[model samples]
Target: MAALSRLLLAALLAFAAPAFGLAQQPAAPEAEAPQVLRFRFKPPADGRLAYRIVQRDRVVFAGTEKARAWSHVVEVRVGGARPPDMLEATITLSDVRLDEGPADDPYYLVAKTLEGRALPAVLHDSGAPVETAWAALKREVAAGLARHTDPETARGLAAALDRLDPEGVTVLYRPLYLASVGHLLGFNTDGSVRSYDDYTGPGAVMVDGRWAASAAGRREGEPVVLELGWRIGMDPDAAARALGPVLQGLAEAAARPEDRAAVKARLAAELADGMEMSERADAEYDYALALIARFTHRHVLATAGYGKEAVLEMERIAP
Candidate 1:
């Protein structure tokens, strides 16, 4: 029986090897690869970009799996006074829709409110807003919330504003600011893409590539590093909002000797790793544009059996 099983396995490998086309071995580096590649945007003459973004999320918890997605179109226009390297833009959002999953879900519903809304000043390159811009956005957003006359809605919005204040709003709005620019902006010299193996990648600009690769080139081929891992910060404001409340509650509750003992014992069991519950994942990006024309960054969360995965993707829709 063992010998038969081994023979069958060997036959399977023989068949699979041919079907898989061996291993897609790399060509001679000098022959196929450019001396260097450039992966930076060539801004249009109008200093405007029109794009479509799709946000997707899936979760499996206690034997149930759920997926949700939102699609929206954004237009960004840049100009006015700013630093040499930095640029400010008015970002407009429209045509928002819940593309997949639960239609009544709050996560999907919130996107509807963004229809025809415009952010006055967000960084053109990074998608993040400047400090003053953020302040203005927050004020405008709060005013919108205050327009709710119902007691329940008003209270809920007030609580949300308080809780999401400081950095929480930024965390939630990161996708809006980013619009998947991270994938398009960070390329090494020679137009090469981000290297997850090294932290030097990401958050770089065209100038950074000029310094590293000497000069940028129009990529005739795909990126050298096609697939790599990326560490994404989904809810950077977590420490202050939900997590902070729990820690603060624990501190307040541990006033008595018995309470302190109980709290310490519970923490010892739960917090063995010192305040980090995270996993690394290789985010998904579709280089439709990266290869030749426009592109999309389909940033996905690996989840690693934790059962929570998300994808924030965007595409260049118009010239």
Candidate 2:
């Protein structure tokens, strides 16, 4: 009887084993792959977004020099709407302060001139001169200079402006362009990767949450930061027709003998230390058009071969 009882117990235990094993197994719903975060622009509702942009520059004239920085508080707003993919936006400079440079520094002067100015919304892709915006900024700079009571200070500021002429306005206004359109250059309507070559190329790098020109070596902290407070959609072609006046102005400028001579001199200087002028018939108009084309078609952000960086940081200040 005992042997029969043992056999029955063993058979019952064997039958329960498979059931216990099944119960112990954990069910996994599914394994999902990690998603990649490709860069793209998502516009906010139509309104103003405020941001603080900071830039640091370290120049080594002899030995390692001290780092310098400047900042601007800007308000950005959508000026027009282009659903889904494109938009137009304006960035206005509300305030500016130089944190790291001497008052006489050219960089500091440039920062001072940028305060209380509005960078009008314009097409990033449009190969057109931003004459209207440039004119407005020139006036703004002049007004700022007029406010300075000190003769030396005023003269220094004026000299700085002269040195940065034509290019100075472009440099100052470029931050607005980059902040507004840098990310858009990375995408297309079909959701394909757009070529960086078409815009800024490999001269820049995305840092923190913003784009920066690539640095030679890692700095202890970010040297530049562009905190984007807002972005929204706008019409892509609205600023295209605005180029008419600028083009007309260019035509007029090209007709001037002095302007033509200046272009030739500049071109000659760029070719070599002592490039010979061609004795052939002077193509002044052609030279002017070439210069305009070169300037107008340039990337919104300046390209650096190496040893430079741009750090962009985006933040939302409004719903």
lDDT of candidate model 1 versus the reference: 0.40
TM-score of each: 0.52, 0.42
On residues 217-312, what C-alpha lDDT tens digit does candidate 2 reach at each position? 112343332111111111112211222232233223333455655544442332222111000000001121111100000111100100111233
Q: What is the lDDT of residue 8 in candidate 1?
A: 22
Clash pairs of candidate 1?
Answer: 36-190, 37-190, 37-191, 38-190, 38-191, 39-191, 289-294
Model 1 C-alpha lDDT per residue in residues 1-319, reported as the tens digit of each score: 1221222222111211221111123334565453433333334567676777677766442234577788777676766646654566677677877678655333333335445876665453444444324444544554554332344544455446544435432323444443333334343333333333322222211111111111122223544324322232222133223243344343333235556666445444333222221222222233443321232333221111212334555556666
Clashing pairs in 2: 80-234, 81-234, 87-234, 88-234, 210-312, 212-310, 213-309, 213-310
RMSD to truth, every model: 11.3, 25.3
| Local error of candidate 2 at residue 20 (angstroms) | 51
Candidate 2 lDDT: 0.34
For candidate 1, the per-residue lDDT at 301 reads 19
